[model samples]
Structure formats: structure tokens, C-alpha cells
Target chain A: AQRVTQPEKLLSVFKGAPVELKCNYSYSGSPELFWYVQYSRQRLQLLLRHISRESIKGFTADLNKGETSFHLKKPFAQEEDSAMYYCALRASGAGSYQLTFGKGTKLSVIP
Target chain B: DTAVSQTPKYLVTQMGNDKSIKCEQNLGHDTMYWYKQDSKKFLKIMFSYNNKELIINETVPNRFSPKSPDKAHLNLHINSLELGDSAVYFCASSPMVGGGGGDMDTQYFGPGTRLTVL
Candidate 1:
């Protein structure tokens, strides 16, 4: 059974403060993780993927295989960054095509 | 232009009625998918089509049917809808998996259709 868990349903942070949205997954194969964001009244969009190893909009997430985690982090939180974030995982072997998404975390960067 | 788009951003209807939500993608991607997001904000994949072929089908009710006439279009039709079906339905697309690094495949989502069953 593959599952993605985002423990925090709501995370509030002050502007310029550091932010970390935790995510964990349960899977038996290699993991391809991603962080997606949905801003207010906007469509859900891709923020970043672990495989890209790149930062998007000052947010970065690293795939921790040992911990089975892919936590999204940002040194400085911006008000515009407040949105619903989802952590997803994809299997590597035979079932690598479909994505399993977490319940999602709502990050509120209060000014 | 939007890569993925869905019609009827807001739909309000009664139970026992049938409805259809249309989706189209202009990214020329080979894979398209339908997802359901409940009020609790839990998103789950309902169906997936790649190059006009059904590749992934989650445990969805028979009343919820998806139709994809081509690689660029995938529509969902619900028959005798129930109140429990009220939720946000999202359509997404992505390039074919595997080939140029499967991990690089990123799905682009539509604005989503909010179905309100009364």
C-alpha cells in the first residue's frame, strides 16, 4: 500500500520567517516525490519535483529516502506563498506511472 | 493559452440527474487524468488515459464514467448523481511516462469544476 501523508492541515507563519511543511510516504520501491501548490482562486500548479533538484519560487524540497520524507522548505516565507500544498509520490517499478497524493497542507504566510 | 482547461467552473444540480464535465489539454501531452477533491481537500485519482488508451483506473463507482475520444480530450459523465458526488473535479495532463527520465514528468492541472449536488 502506497500512501502520502501531510500531517499538518494548516501551518501559519509570519512573513520573512522560515517555513517547513512536512511530508512522509509509505512505499516499497524507489520514490519520485513532488510538491504542488494551489494559490487562492488559482489552479493547482507544480512547484517542484525531487528529481529536478531545483527550487521554485524560493521553495525547495529534498527527497530523504532514509526518512521516507520529502519536506518542503523555504528560508523566508512570503505572503504570496500562502496556499494549499500537496506532497505526492510515484513508484519506480511497475506502478511508476500513477501518482499518489497526500491530503495536503495549507500554508498561511501571515503578514 | 491554458495547458489544461475544464468547462462549467461551477455546476449546481439536483440528485438523480446526469451531468458531464468536459476537459481539454493543449500541451500535446499523451497522458490525461481525472481527479476528485473532496471538501476535506483530499485529492484522489479517478481515471487516467494515455494516448487514447485507459492506463489507470482507480476504484470509482460505475456511475462515474470517463470518455476520451482522443489524446487531447477527456470528459467525465456522471449518471444518477448523488449528493455525495458534490466536490471539485480536476483535470490534468502530462507527457508520457518513462523515456526521458520518468521522474521529470510533471502534471499540469486545470482550473477545476466544482459540482454541487443538492
Candidate 2:
């Protein structure tokens, strides 16, 4: 069974501090991983995907196949960065549109 | 303009009633999906349609049915709604995989519809 796990239900950090939200996945084949963010009163949006390998909003996530992890990280946390983060994994194959998502982690960047 | 939109941002009703949630996407994508977010905020895919054809269907209850009249519209209907159905439903669309050069992995989500079963 394919599953995504976000162990931290809530992660609090002071402004300007480094931030990391852990994400791990269990899949038999190669997976396309993504990070999605939902801010207060805003619709859920895509933050970034491992395939793109591009940083968004100063946050970066590296896919570690050996560790089966794709932890999102930021050098300096900002108040605006506070939101619910979800880690999703898509199996790489034909006709697979389902995104297996982890229970989201709420990040609170306190000023 | 909203890329993806869902009707009735919030729905509150008694259990055992029937209801429907409509979703539409103007992004011209070839694939659309429905996801349910539980109270714990665990998002799970319920169904997916590609070019108006059902492509993926998870282990959702048979009481829940998804209809896609076209590629841009996908609607979900629930019969005899139960308390367990109280949650947020999100509609999303993405470019078709193996269709072209665009990023098919990135999905655009609609404002969720929060359903409360009293």
C-alpha cells in the first residue's frame, strides 16, 4: 500500500528560525512527491514538487529516495509562512491521478 | 477568475438526507479529481476523471457517486448522508499526464466545500 506520513501534527518556530517539516512515504515504485500549503481563509495551493526541483517562497524540499523522505525546509521562518502543509505522493505509472496525502502539519511561525 | 470552483462553500444538514456538490474548472485541464479532508485534516482522493472518463476510484462508499458530464465539470452526490460524511471536499484539476509539456503533477484546487451532518 502507498502511504504518505507527516509525523508532526503541529510545528512551532520563532520568526527567523530555521524550519523543517518532516514527510516520509511508502511506495514500491518511483513516486512523484509534492508539497502543498493552505493558508488561513485561502484555498489550498501547490507549493512545489520534487520533480521541478525549484524552491518556492524560500522553502526547499529534497527527495531522498534512500530514506523515503521529502522533508520541506526553510532557512528562516517568517510569520507569513504559517499554514497547513501537506505532503503528497503520486505513483509513477499510467492512469494514476490519485495523490496519496499525509495528514497535514500545521506550522506556526511566532513573531 | 477562479481556476477551480465548488458550489455551496458550506453545507449543513441532517443525517440521512441527500446532497450534491458541484465543481467546475476553467483551466482547460484534461483531468479532475475529488478529495475528502477529514476532521484530522487527512486528505484522501475519492475519485478522478480524465476527459470525462472515470480514471481512478478509491475505496469510497457506494453511496457516494461522482458524475462528470464533461472534462470541466465534476459533481459528487451522496445518498443517505451519515455523520461520518461531515468533512471538507475539495475539487482539483491538473493537466493530463503524457499529454504535453506542461507540469501534469501540479494540481489546482478549488475552495473547499465544508459539509456538516447534524
Candidate 3:
């Protein structure tokens, strides 16, 4: 069974402050981790994936297999970054395209 | 132009009534999905279709049925709706699963429909 855990339901940070959204997972096999963001009144979009190792809109996430964590981090928080963030995991295998998502964390960046 | 779109952005209905939520994707992808987001903002996969074929079906109730008339359209119909069914329903699409190291499993989501079962 593969499960993603995002413990924080809400997180607040002052402008220009650092942001870290914690995420942990439990999976038997190797899994691909991803971070998704949903802005207000907008559709959910992919932020970054561990496989790509690329930063999007100043957000980045690294998959740590040993710790079973793929926490998302940003150097400086911005008001526009405030949105619902979800951590998802996809198991490794052929035809395993299902994405198990966490409960999600609501990040609020105060201006 | 919206890549993925769902109709009836907001719905309010009485209990026991049957309703359908329509979803269509113009991205020409081979896979489509339906997800439910509860009040707690917990998103879960309900159904998935690939090339008009039922590929993935989760532990959802029988009352919730998904239909794919074509590769681009997927509709969800709920019968004898219950109060617990009131939540936001989202439609998404993605390309087929490729070998590796590509945008194969990346899904593009629709605007989502807010269903209110009164």
C-alpha cells in the first residue's frame, strides 16, 4: 500500500520568509513523488516532480528515499504562493499510473 | 481554450435525485480520470479510463458510475445521491504511460465541479 502524509492542514509564513511543507510517504517499492499546487479559483497544476529535479515558480522538492520524505521548500515566501499544496506518489511498475495524494496543506503567505 | 473542462460548475439538488457531471478534454490525450475532493480537502481517485476503456476503478460505490463515450469525454453519473456525496468533483487527463523520464504520467486537471446535495 502506498500512502502520502501531509501533516499540516494550514501553514502561515511572513513575506520573504522561508517555507517548508512537510510530506512523508509509506510505500513498499520505489515511488515517484510529485508536488501539486492549486491557486484560488484555478485548476490544480503540477509544481515539480522528484524525477525532473527542476524548480517551478521558486518551489522545489527532493525525494529522500531513506527518510521516506519529499518535503517541498522555498527560499522566500510570496503572497501569490499561497494556495493548496498536495503531495502525491505513484508506485513504480508498468501500468501503475495511479497517483495517491495526501490530505493537502494550505499555505498562507502574509504580505 | 481549456485543455480539460467540466460542465455544471456548481450543482445543488435534493436527495435521491440522479445527476450527471460531464467532462471533456481537448488535449487529445488517451487517459482520463475522475477525482473527488471532500470537505476536508482530501482528494481521492474514483475512476480512470484509457482510450475509452475502463482501466482503473477504485473502491467507490455502485451508485457512482463513470462512462466514457469516446477518448476525450468522460461522464460521471450518481444515482440516489446522498448527503455524503456532496463534494467537489474534478476531471483530469494525461498521456499514456511511456517508458520513463518523460511527461508521461503528468496529468492536466479541469476546473472542477462543485456538487451540493441538499
Top-scoring candidate (lDDT): 3
- The residue-by-residue lDDT of candidate 1 on A1-111, one tens digit each, is 789999999999999999999999999877788898999888888899888899899999999999999999999999999999999887776546788999999999999
Q: Which regions of candidate 3 fall more than 4 Å away from where they truly are?
A: B98-101
Better of 1 and 3 by lDDT: 3
TM-score of chain B of 3: 0.96
**RMSD in angstroms, all models?**
1.3, 1.4, 1.0
lDDT of each: 0.91, 0.92, 0.93
Q: Residue-wise lDDT of candidate 2 within A1-111, one digit each (tens)?
A: 799999999999999999999999999988889999999878889999888889899999999999999999999999999999999888887655678889999999999
Report the C-alpha lDDT of model 3 over A1-111, residue by residue, as the tens digit.
899999999999999999999999999988999898999988898888899999899988989999999999999999999999999998888778688999999999999
Q: lDDT score, residue A25, model 3?
A: 100
**After superposition, candidate 1 runs with Cα above 4 Å error:** B99-104
Per-model TM-score versus the true fold: 0.97, 0.96, 0.97
Model 3 lDDT on a 0 to 1 scale: 0.93
Which digits, one per residue and each the tens of the lDDT, describe model 1 over residues B1-118? 8579999899999999999999999999999999999999899999999899888899999999999999999999999999999999999999876434443478889999999999
